[model samples]
Target: MKYFIITGTSRGLGEAMAFKLISPEHQLICISRTKNNDLIAASSHLDYYEFDLQNVNQIEALMEQVFQKINLTNADGVYLINNAAIISPFSRIEQANSQDLMDNLHVNLLAPIVLTSSFIRLTQHLPLEKRILNISSASAKQLLPGMSAYSAAKAGLDAFSSCVGLEQGVESAAVKIVSVYPGMVDTSLQEQARNTSNEALTTPDIFKMVKDRGMLASPAATADKLISFLLGHSFHQGAVVEDLFL
Candidate 1:
């Protein structure tokens, strides 16, 4: 049996991933701002925690409470999946407010870093095979005219994860860090990005494009692939794992 911690379990990819990881034999701890009734009604091994990732200072306390409840430190291995993110509706850089950009940074970049750091510290006594999978975006690689802040933050996160992987190797720890770029999916964020008033947005008619090209995959499909990769493949083979067109 394996223990897993996943964030943003209320909806979208996070929700799908949580359900994918649930089974009679494994344990799943899901965190989000609101409780997901589906996950709550699932197996007893599934647990849920309601916390706002925007409140960065409470993350450590929240983790402590979760570990205390699950007794996770005694486990042979743990998987920390940082899958939560926020995208600003503002399309243009000038149109984006300072606070909105900062909020994006908090949720997208800072929160993941802090959580991964905490995971490393908390699992210091655990055996090898502990993994930290960071959900990233292709936007980090290509510049989208409208999504400046979101793209920048994800890029920072990718860089941070790469550095963490190197540091772990140097420390002779078995903990592996992987930054994954899951291709665009049919999610609310896509809807919002498509509707945002960004004149220079390169992803013109985002919803229509996704529909026309049949490019958007279901969240469940993406979740399944991610779980398969995490369990069956070695993420340490590469610092950044690209899951495009999967």
Candidate 2:
């Protein structure tokens, strides 16, 4: 059996991935701020945690609780999908809110780093295949106005992924880590971006244009492609991928 610990499983791509991964051969442990009732009713193989990622200080304890549900001795693989993030307070650096910046960095960067560290530390001796997939965005590399905090966090995450990948390379039981940009998906983040004031986002029309042109990918489709690449032979550890390997 393979165990998957996924964050932000309430909705969007995270939710889609959770649904796609449900099976008798795989057990899913999902963490999110709120629980999805439909998801819970759909599978007995799922273990849902209605806890917030912003509380980074408690993630280790939370993971310990999550690990209790798994039988590590018989597991063939363990996966952590750091898919939780918030893109808000869209403003220029000069105008950004301090609390917003802190919250954004906390959820998007710090939480993932801490979680990855915990996963690596806890499973270091395990001989099973271990992999970490960090859900990233194009904003990390693009120079968009009013996205300083979000962009910085994502860029930092990418750098962190590279460093950890290097650290794992020499280990006897190495863990595969990859940060991927999942392309433009029609999620709540996009809605927030589209609804932001012109003062906050200088390129507000970009979001509008994407929707108008019907270019935004669906969450289910994007999740399908991402999961395929994640579980497929083409996956490369330590790669800072710009595309979804599409």
Candidate 3:
């Protein structure tokens, strides 16, 4: 059986991914802010943990509870997707609230690192292939106004992934680390962006284009590609594993 531990599975791209991977052969553990009855009713293989990623103090204990559901003895593979994020307080660097910035860091940057470490420590002896996917953004590469907090957090995630990959290479561990930049999907994040009161921010205009021109990608389609990559079902074997973005 394959194991998948995904964060932010209650809605949007994360929700898309959770439903995409459900199967008799796949055991899913979702971390979210609320319980998903539909997901639980979908299959016995589905399980979830409802907790805020912003609560940095409880992550360790939470992960312990998560691992209890996994059947490591019969596990064929493992995957971790750090998909939870916040789009609030989308303001310029100076105008951003201190509390908002801190919250963003906790959810977007720190949670993934904590979860990745937990996965590595727990699965070291499992003798199964493991993959880590960090959901990143185009904002990480460009200077977009009003996205200072989001941009900084995602850029940090990408750099962190690279460093982890390098360290693993020296020891030759059987693990894959990637940061995926899922192109603008038709998600609620857009709604949040559009509602921001920051007048200096240009995100609203971009979001408007996405909505009016029908340029947004479907989360379900993106989820399929991401899961395919994790399962090593890709057609392009020569592609750099570090560059996969759904």
Candidate models: Cα lDDT each: 0.81, 0.89, 0.81
Which window of ten consecutive residues has the lowest lDDT sum in model 3?
234-243
**Runs of candidate 2 exceeding 4 Å displacement:** 170-172, 198-200
Highest TM-score model number = 2
Of candidates 3 and 2, the better by lDDT = 2
List TM-scores for all candidates, in order.
0.92, 0.97, 0.92
Q: Mind giving the per-residue lDDT tens digits that candidate 3 earns over 1-246? A: 999999999889999999999899999999999888888888799888899999987888888888887878898888888999997668877887899999999999999989888887887666787778888887788767888889889889988888777655533344667776777788888778867766777778877877889888888987877777767655221122434553
- How well is each residue in 87-153 modelled by candidate 2, as lDDT tens digits? 8768888787788889999999999999999999888889998999999888899968878889999
Q: What would the TM-score be for candidate 3 when compared with the true structure?
A: 0.92
lDDT score for residue 143 of model 3: 67
lDDT of 1 by residue, 1-246 (tens): 688999988999999999998887678989989999989898699888898888899898888877776555556558889999988845687877888888899999988988988888887666656888899998898776777888898899899999988777744455788889878888877777767666666655765687678888889998988887777655672278776434
Best by lDDT: 2
Cα deviation at 166, candidate 1, in Å, is 0.7
